[model samples]
Target: MQTGNLLLLLLVMIAGAYYLGHRRALILARPLGGIRHLHSLPFYFAMRSAIWSALPALLVLASWLAFENSIIRAVVVGGMAESAQPADPAAMNLVISQIQNVASGAIPASFVSQDVAQAAEQLSRLQNLSGMAMTVVVLVLAMLGSAWAWLQVSPRMRARQKVERVLQTIFMVCATLAILTTVGIVMSVLFESMQFFSKIPVTEFLFGLQWSPQTALRADQVAAQGAFGAIPLFVGTLLISAIALLVAVPVGLMSAIYLAEYAPARVRSFAKPALEVLAGVPTVVYGFFAALTVAPFIRNLGESVGLSVDSESALAAGLVMGVMIIPFVSSLADDVITAVPQALRDGSLGLGATRSETIKKVVFPAALPGIMGGILLAASRAIGETMIVVMAAGLAANLTINPLESVTTITVQIVTLLTGDQEFDSAKTLAAFALGLMLFITTLVMNMVALHIVKKYREQYD
Candidate 1:
C-alpha cells in the first residue's frame, strides 16, 4: 500500500479503538459505583487502546516501505538468465534505471529490448501484488491488536503504565537514531578520507605550499603529477572568515544590544523583524549582489585610488557573507541579552550607574556566554558560505593574507573537485572527502571549545 494510505488507515483504526475503549471502560466501571473503581482515568484507557492499534500497523507499513525498492530491483534482475544479466553492479543499476523509466512511461516500450520490456511488466505486477498483500496484512494487524487490547481492558489493567512506557520507548528510539546517524556520517567520511590519504601523503595535503589537483590522464600529458598542497585553500578560508567575523561581530552585537535593551517597545517590535529579514534573503541572491554589485564596486574603487584589487576579491565576498550572517549573531545575542535578569540591571542603576554603564557591567557580563555562542555560530556560517565566495572571490587558490587578492576556500575546492562524474580511486575526487573530514573536525573542535568556554565562565545572575 502507498505509505500515505497506510497512515490514514492506521489513524482511522486508532480513532475507532479509542471510542470503543472509552465506552468499554465506562461499562466496566458502572457496576463498581462509577470510575473511582477504575485504576486510571478513561482517557488513559482510550489512549492505551489507540497506541495498540497504531503501533503494530505503523511498524508493518514502515518495514514494507523500507525494503520495497531493493526487493523489487532484485526480483526483476534475478529473473534474467545468467547470460543476459548485467556484467557488474554498476551496469545492473543502469539497466534497472532504464527499466524503471520504461515502466513509469518515461521511455516508450519499443525503446528497450524485449527482455527488459518483459522485466518491466513483471516489476509492475509484483509491485501491485506486494501493495495488496501489505494493505491486507497491516489492516489485519491493526484490527487484531485493537481487539486484544479491548478484551484485556479491565479495571485492574495498568493502562497508564503501558501507555507511558510505549511513548518513552518511542522517544528513546528517536534519540538513538539521531546519534547513530551522526556517527554513521563521521565513519563514512573517515573511511573515504583514508582512501584519499592512501593516494596522497598526509603531510603534502596538510602542509605543502602548492594547490594544483589536475592529474594528467596520460604519461605524455602536460602537468602529469598534480600538486595536492592545501595550504592555499586553508589560508583563503581563514582570511575570508576572519574578514567576515570582523564585520559581523561588532555590528551584529551592537545592533542586538540596542534593539533588545535600549530601543523602545514600538521600535523593538518593528526593528528586530526588519533586521532579521536579511537572514531570510537567499544566499544565491546575496551571491548575485556580491558578484554583480559589490565585487565590481570594490575593484573600481581600488582602481581610482591607484591600488590593485582583483575583480573578484575576497573583501567583497567576506563583506557579503558578513551581511548574510548578521541576523544569526543579532537574533541570538538579542535573545541572550534579554534573558539576563532585570534585577541585575536594577542593582546597577541603584548604584548610580548610567544605563549604558549598567548594560556593559551587569547585562553584558551575565550574557557573555550566549554572545560568544552567537559569534561562534556566525563564524561557522561565514566559513561554510560557498555561493557568495564562489561568485565574488575568483577560484584562484592564492595563499595571501591580503583581502584584495582573489582566493578560494576548502568548500569551493571540494565542490570543484567533485563536480562531474568521478572515479572513486582518483586523488582528485578523494581529496574532496579529505577536505570534508578536515572541515568536520575543525567545526567539531570549535564547538567543543565554545561549549567549554561557556560552561567555565557562565554565572547565574539570579
Candidate 2:
C-alpha cells in the first residue's frame, strides 16, 4: 500500500477502536447507573475510554513513523552482504540507489546484473513482509488497548479529569515540539558558525571595518583577505529599518487611532483590509519596484535638490519596507487599543475630555505597550528582510549613515555568502551560519523584550 493510504488506514482503525472502547465503557458503567451516577456525564466516560484506547496506539504509530526510514535504510545496507559491498562510499551509494530502483520496479535492463537482481528480489520480499507485519501488529495493539480501557471504566471513574489531563499533556507535547524545533535550528546554526569561526578569527571578523567576501578557489592564485566586519551590514539594516519605522509607525498608529476611536464602521471595514493589501505584496515585487521605480524617482528628486544620490540607495528600500510593515503595526495596535476597557474612555469623556483628548491621554497610553510590542515585531521583520535591500541597496558595505548612498544588510550578506557553489566547511559558508546565529539572537531578544512589556502591561490592566 502507498504510504498515505497506510496512514489513513491507521487513522481509521484508531477511530474505530476509540468508538468500540467508548461503547464498551458505557456498557460496563450501565450496571452501576453509568453516567447518571458518575461525577461526569456518560459521554465523558466514553471520551475517556476513547482517548485511553487511542493514545498508546497513536504513540506507537508515531514512533514507528519517525524511525521507519532509518531502520529500513540500515536493514537494506546490511543486507547487501560483504561480497556486493563497494570499496568507495560514492560507488556503494550508486549501487544502493540501483538496488532501490530495482526493488521499486523502476530499474531498466541497462543497470541489471545477477547479484543486484538477487538483492533487489530479496529486499522487495523483506520490505513487503515487514510492512504487513507492522500493520497487523499496530492494529492488534490498538484492539487490545481498546479492550483494556473499556474494562477500566466504572460509575466512580473521574473521566472528565482524566480526559482534561490527557488534553493538557497533548498541548504540552505540541508546545515542546515547537520549542525543540526552534532549539534545533539554533543549534544547527551555532555549530555551523563555530566551524566558520575556527577558520576565521572572531576578533578579525567582528572588528574589521571593510566587507568583501570574494576568494580564489585555486591555491596558486592570490586570494583577497575577506573583511568580515559586520558593522556596515548591521548599520545598513538599522538605517533602512529606522526609515521604515519612521514611515510606518506614524501612518500605522494614526490609522489605527482613527479606526479605533473615530472612523465610521463602514470606513474601517473597507480601509483596514485595503491597508493590509500592502502587507500581502510579495517582497520580490517590492524589490524590483524599489530597484527600478522608487530608486530612480528618489535619485531624480535628489538631483533636483542638488544632492548626489546612488541609483541603488538605502532610502528607496527602506521606504518600501516601511510601507510593507505598516499594516503589521497598525492591525496589531488597533486590536490592542480596541481591547482596552471601554470604561476608561467613558470616564475620560465624562470628565469633559474630547474624543481626541481621551484617545491621546487615556486610550493610547493604555495600549502603548502592545503598540510598542507590535512595532518591535515589525522591526524584527524589517531587519531580516532580504530582497528589497538586495535589489536596491548596493553590495558595498559603507559605514556612513547616508540613506542616499549604497548599503547592504546582514540578510543580504548571508544570501550572497551561501548562494551558488559553496563548500559547507569553508569560512565563507560558515559566515552565513554565523550571521544567521546573530540574526536569530537579535530577533529572539527583541521578541522577549516585546513579550515582557506586553505581559507587564497585561498584568497592570488585569
Q: Pick by TM-score: which candidate is best?
A: 1
lDDT of 2: 0.82
Backbone collisions counted per model: 0, 0
Candidate 2 lDDT by residue in tens digits, 37-115: 6666666766776676567766776787788756776677677668877788878788778888998889963578777
lDDT of 1: 0.91
Tens-digit lDDT track of model 1 for 1-462? 676877787889999999999999999999999999999898889998888898898898889889988998899999977776899889888889888988888999899988888889988888889999999999999999999889989999888998999999999999999999999999999999999899899999999889989886555767567888999999999999999988889999999999988899999999999999999999999999999999999999999999999989999999999999999999999999999888888999999999999988889988989998998999899889888889999799898989999999999999999898877778888899999999998899989999987887684443
Model 2: residue 325 alpha-carbon error in angstroms: 1.6
Worst 10 residues of 1 by lDDT: 453-462
List the lowest-lDDT window of 10 residues for candidate 2: 33-42
User: What is each predicted model's overall lDDT from 0 to 1?
Assistant: 0.91, 0.82
